[model samples]
Target: AWCCGAGGGVKSAFPDLALWTAGQRVDEALSTGATVLSSACPFCKRNLSDGAGNRNVRVTDIVELVAQAMSGRRMGLT
Candidate 1:
């Protein structure tokens, strides 16, 4: 697992850097052939989703996945 780069006010103080960091992490995830990246933090989700822009990967929260599962809905990016 990697830091989503939105922690410690990085997203607010250094948005570009945070995005770059998240992109790097996303690249690592893609290297693993992952189609989805899940996080428990809303900040992480937001940053990861932004970093995954135009990429064939989905960034979502664990709660969302759980909700989808409970609701019998197909899991997907909203």
Candidate 2:
């Protein structure tokens, strides 16, 4: 799972800059040939997914993905 963008302070006040940062991350993810991108932080998830290319990559929370993989569910994990 990619940390996606710069995280924390970088994504708070400067969203456009954060998107650019996430774009760089997307390039790295594409190089890895990974379809799903997982992040622990909710803000990171939203920022990265929003900045990511259209349907080029799927973004999800790490806990949620694990639950899905295990055929289980997560509560209050958004």
For candidate 1, the TM-score is 0.86
Question: What TM-score does candidate 2 reach?
Answer: 0.75
TM-score of each: 0.86, 0.75
Error of 2 at 69 (Å): 1.3
List clashing residue pairs in candidate 1.
none
> Whose lDDT is greatest here?
1
Give the Å shift of residue 21 in candidate 1. 0.4
The lDDT of each candidate is: 0.91, 0.76
Give lDDT: candidate 1, residue 60: 82
Cα misplacement distance, residue 43 of candidate 2 (Å)? 1.0
Assess candidate 1 and give its lDDT: 0.91
Please, what are the lDDT tens digits per residue for candidate 1 over residues 1-78? 779899999999999999999999999999998888889999999999999989989988899788988999987545
